[model samples]
Target: MIVIVDYGLGNLGSIKNMLRKIGYSSMVSSNPDEISKASKLILPGVGAFDTGMRHLTDSGLLDILGYKALAEKIPVLGICLGAQLMTRSSEEGCLSGLGWFEAETLKFQFDGIAGKWPLPNIGWRDVFDVNGSPLLSGFNSTPRFYFVHSYFLKPLEQDIVSMNVSYGFEYACGLSKGNLHCVQFHPEKSHKFGMQLLRNFSELT
Candidate 1:
C-alpha cells in the first residue's frame, strides 16, 4: 500500500482524499515500520523548512524515510515543502535537508521583475512538461497547477527537471530522478490534471 508520511505537518487529509478519488489505497502514518514497508511513499508538508525537518527528525522518520527512499530505492513523491526537503539545504533554514537531490531551496527574489508578481506565488499557473516524464503522463495540453509558496527549488542538475513554470521568471517546479520525484505545486488541488498525475504515480513500479 502507498503510505503518506505523517510527521505533524501537511494537509494529510487532502492528499489521502485525492488518492482515494484515484482509486488508490493510502495510509497516513508516522510509524517507521509502516513507512518502511510502503510500496510507494508520499511526503507532504506545509510549513517552515526547519520545522518540517525537525518534526521528521523528532519523530524518528528522518532516517527511516531516508533509508527507504534513498537506500532501498523506493518510489517517493514529495509535495511542496516536502519537495524542498529533498534538496541539500534551504535558504529558508540552516538545517540540512534529506539530500536526495543535488539542489537547494531558495526564497524567490523580486529583483528586476519587481511588481510583475507577488511573493508566495498563489493561484493557478501553467506548467510545461519539458521532459514528458511518466509522472506527468496524459498531459496532452498545457496544464495548470495550483501553487502557494515563497520559495522554489534550484536543482544543480537540470536534466532531472521534468517540468518548469514561469512566475517572475522560469523555475523548476517538477523533478524526477530514479526513485525520487517531486512537485512544487499541489497536485491534490490541481483538479483533473492533478488526479492524472497521482494515478500515474500509482502505476509506477
Candidate 2:
C-alpha cells in the first residue's frame, strides 16, 4: 500500500483522495511501523522548510524513512515543500534537509524582472521534460501542473532534473534519482494532469 506521510503538514486528504480517484488505496500515517511497510511513499508538505523538517524529526520517523528510501529503495515521491526538504538545505531556513539530492532550495531572484512577477509563483505552468521520468509517462501533450511557491530547487547534478518550469526564469520543478522522485508542482490540485501523473506513479515498478 502507498503511505501518505503525516508530519503535521501537507494536504494529506487531498493526496489520498486523488490516489483513490485513480483506484489506488493509500494510508495516512505517522507511525514508523506503518510507514516501513509501505510499497511506495508519498511525502507531502505545505509550509516553511524548517517547520516541516522539525515536525518530521519530532515524529520520529526520520531514521525509518532514511532506511526505506536509501536502503530499501522503495519508490518515494515528494510534493512541494516536501520536495524542497529532500534537498541539502533551503534558503527559507537554516536546518539541514534529508539531503537525498545534491541540491538546495532558493528563493526566486527576478533581478532585472523583479517587480514583473511577484513572490509565491502561484498558477498553472507547463513543464519541460528534461529526462523522461516514468512519473510523467502517458502524456500525449506537454503537461501542465499547478505551482504555488516562492522558492525552487536548484540541483548541482543537472541530469537528475526530470522537469523544468518557467516562472521569472526556468528552474527545476521535478527531480528523479533512482527510485526517488519529487515535484515542486501540486499534482493533486492540477485536475486531469495531476491525476495522470499520480496514475503513472501508482504504476511504477
Best candidate (score: TM-score): 2
- By summed lDDT, the worst window of 10 consecutive residues in model 1 runs over 110-119
Candidate 2 clash total? 0
lDDT of all predictions: 0.92, 0.94
For candidate 1, the TM-score is: 0.97
Task: Estimate candidate 2's RMSD in Å.
Answer: 0.9
Q: 1-205 in candidate 2: lDDT tens per residue?
A: 9999999999999999999998999999999999989999999999999999999999998999999999999999999999999999999999999999889999988888754898789999998888888888889999999999998999999999999989878889999999999999999999999999999988888
lDDT of 1 by residue, 18-43 (tens): 99998999999999999988999999
Error of 2 at 138 (Å): 0.5
Highest lDDT among the candidates is held by which one? Answer: 2
- TM-score of candidate 2 to 2 decimals: 0.98
**Lowest summed lDDT window (length 10), candidate 2:** 110-119
